[model samples]
Target chain A: MPYNVDAVFQIAGIGIIVAMIHTILKQMGKEDWAHWVTLIGFIIVLFMVAMLIRDLFQTIKNVFLFHS
Target chain B: MIQVVGLGVVATILILLVKEQKPMFAFLLATFVGIVIFLTVIGKITEILKVLAHLANQAKVNQFFLETILKIIGIAYIAEFGAQVTRDAGQGTIAAKIELAGKILIMVMAIPIIITIIETIINILP
Candidate 1:
């Protein structure tokens, strides 16, 4: 299977946008909102990684444990 | 391989750009790219192991021994990947603990082979 390079772009785009929002909010003097934005961005990226990890674990199980 | 390296380079650039303002996100980006790279190469790893197993079978090596060795290697790689990711997230203590667990698991898995070796040595002596 070919690697899905788009996923990397998608994640990086989210990170960049979130960072932008955070800086904008902080400049506007809303530090609390800036922090929340950063947290949300982190959680979104985390969810994506969590799914990838689940897939990795399943592959590992099939590869290492149940030798067909 | 080239594709994976390109992706990593792009991710690294992005992470560097984001690190100043959002260090947490930068760390997450690094971890995500690491896993993505691993996943992309996993198919190649499986293919290589299958070829190795076939060669071992042809050479009259014990299948069980080959399988155990492969499993131990898999555990080591997975555990190292996990620990490194944890360390990248700034949890050095937890990373060390993960390494300890992997070593313990490897020792447990190797016991049967160790016993076989010892038994063979005993049989050959005097």
Candidate 2:
């Protein structure tokens, strides 16, 4: 299967946006908010990656196991 | 493969750019890129495994042994991946522990095959 080029773009875009927001908040002296924003952004990206990892594991199980 | 490489290069550049101002975000970006690369190549890995299984079947290898070996390999790959990610996050001690666990699990998985080999050797010896 060909790679999903869009996923890469999506992740990088999210990272950039999150970093921008984090910087803005930090510069404004809202350190707590900045941290939370960065955390949330990281979690959002992590959720997407986690789902992909799950699918990968499912495929691996199907390939490696005889009963599956 | 080309797509993954391209994505990885982009991510590396972004991480380098962000690291000075925001180290935490840089780490997250690195990890996200790693996962993306892993996800993209997983399909090809499954295909290779399927081909290997087919070849093993054609050779009349024991199904159980083949399955066990495959599982062990999968465990090793996953453990190493996890360990490396943890290492990248700056937890070198945790990464070492992860690798140690993986090694122990792999040895446990191989015990049955080892026993069988020893048994066969004993039978052949005078």
Candidate 3:
């Protein structure tokens, strides 16, 4: 919960960076590279986000006691 | 919030630059960025879902209803995501089919809830 904002920043920053690289690659007529860049960026961000989701669910579990 | 906004603006600019030259890649880029943003906030979404689950439990709501609601939401999300992605890829027909599938799935999910509600009402009529 506390690091929620931090996670947002991290993921968004990655997204923007990926977007930038993607733009550059496209402008250079390297569509394939651009696509892979987007895919890789997505996977990296997804991994981090998956951790964040887990953390969030844990917090919710504590609050709601959904364990039982 | 600033970070999210900045990322959004940058992604928008990038998308604009890339769209015409490489429209297909641009769509994937957009989808990727969108998913990134969604992922960043997924924590909050889960929290809300858990809260709903808690409320359902406290109110002694039927498990069947809970499962059905979850499944319906899943179908809606999948359909919406698929349709949007296809539309972004310039495939309107595919998007339409995805939407139709989602609607059918929702109708199927609703049947049990409808029947249960009807049964509950009938029981109260006596």
Q: Best candidate, TM-score-wise?
A: 1
Better of 2 and 3 by lDDT: 2
Residue-wise lDDT of candidate 2 within A1-68, one digit each (tens)?
Answer: 43455665676677777778888988999999988987887788778767766765666566555354
The 0-to-1 C-alpha lDDT of every candidate, in the order given, reads 0.83, 0.76, 0.68
Q: Clashes in model 2: which pairs?
A: none
Global lDDT of model 3: 0.68
- What DockQ does model 2 achieve? 0.40
Candidate 3 per-residue C-alpha lDDT over A1-68 given as tens digits, one digit per residue, 9 for 90 to 100: 22334444454556667778888999999999998988887777656645654554454344333333
lDDT of 1 by residue, B49-121 (tens): 8898889999999988988888788789889989999999889999999999999999998999999999999
Flag regions of model 3 displaced more than 4 Å: A1-68
Residue range B99-125, candidate 3, lDDT tens digits: 999999899989989998999999999
Q: What would the per-residue lDDT of candidate 2 be over residues B38-121, giving only the tens digit for each residue?
A: 766777777888798889999998887888898788778778888988899889999999999989999998999999889989
* Model 3: how far residue A62 lies from native, Å: 17
Q: Score the docking of each candidate (DockQ).
A: 0.57, 0.40, 0.10
Q: Each predicted model: what fraction of the native A–B Cα contacts (within 8 Å) does it retain?
A: 0.43, 0.22, 0.00
Docking level of model 1: medium
TM-score of each model, paired residue for residue: 0.90, 0.83, 0.64
* Residue pairs in clash, model 3: none
Top candidate by lDDT? 1
* Rank list by DockQ: 1, 2, 3
